[model samples]
Target: MNVHFKYEKNIQIEHLETLYNDVQWYAYTQDLAVLQTAITQSLDVLTAWDGEELVGLVRVVGDGLTILYIQDILILNAYQNQGIATQLMQQILEKYHHIRQKVLLTEEAADVRHFYEKNGFTSCDQGSLVAFAQVR
Candidate 1:
């Protein structure tokens, strides 16, 4: 796949919906306006495109200096396991290499855990750190 990556925020809503829906992220797809606004307000957004098709995306939200939170990383279902997600993540990490506290929250599946762990992220449980969330 000749995937090209771009540091872009002004993504077409159709493309955003396609990627998010294809990856089964239905919540993000529910409100296109909100999704677009969120993307526009993000600190950084890296998108992977195969020609005109947006197959992957990694978005960060934080103050560029101290706290970098990886808000989203998604790969289209057909494109999973092809290293596109990894490359997107690698690039995001590289871009925010100077930021000391990079964080991500994901569901507790084995594959999900393994993916983050392999990408150099440690579980809060493994360290002295603990994470809490007030998900509505």
Candidate 2:
């Protein structure tokens, strides 16, 4: 798998919907306009592609100096468990290594928890940190 990475803002909307929907993250896939705008407006957007296929992406939003929120990190189902997600995240973390707070919220699946934990992210309960979110 020859994957190319880029920190650019010109990915096609159709590609995003394909990747997002592949993992069942319909909240964003349901609205391409919102998703495209969100991604284009992020502080940083890292994408992974195999030739012409959009296989993975990492989107972040925050002040470059203090806080960084990982809004999304996704890899197509066929690409999961292949270290693509880890590489995407490592790129983002390296770019913002000096930031004090790096955060993200994900579902409570065991694999999700395990993935984040392995990447050095602590759960709110584990780190004594409180996280709050509302589903609209």
Which one wins on TM-score?
Answer: 1
CA lDDT of each prediction against the hidden true structure: 0.95, 0.91
Tens-digit per-residue lDDT, 27-120, candidate 2: 8977799999999899999999999999999999998899999989999999889999999998899989999889998889999999999888
> For residues 14-62, could you state the per-residue lDDT of candidate 1 as single tens digits?
9999999997899999999999999999999999999999999999999
Cα lDDT, model 1, residue 82? 94
**How well does model 1 score by local distance difference test?**
0.95
Give the distance in Å from residue 12's predicted Cα in candidate 1 to where it truly belongs. Answer: 0.4
Candidate 2 C-alpha error for residue 112, in Å: 0.9
RMSD of each: 0.7, 1.0
Give me the candidate number with maximum lDDT: 1
Clash pairs, model 1 backbone: none
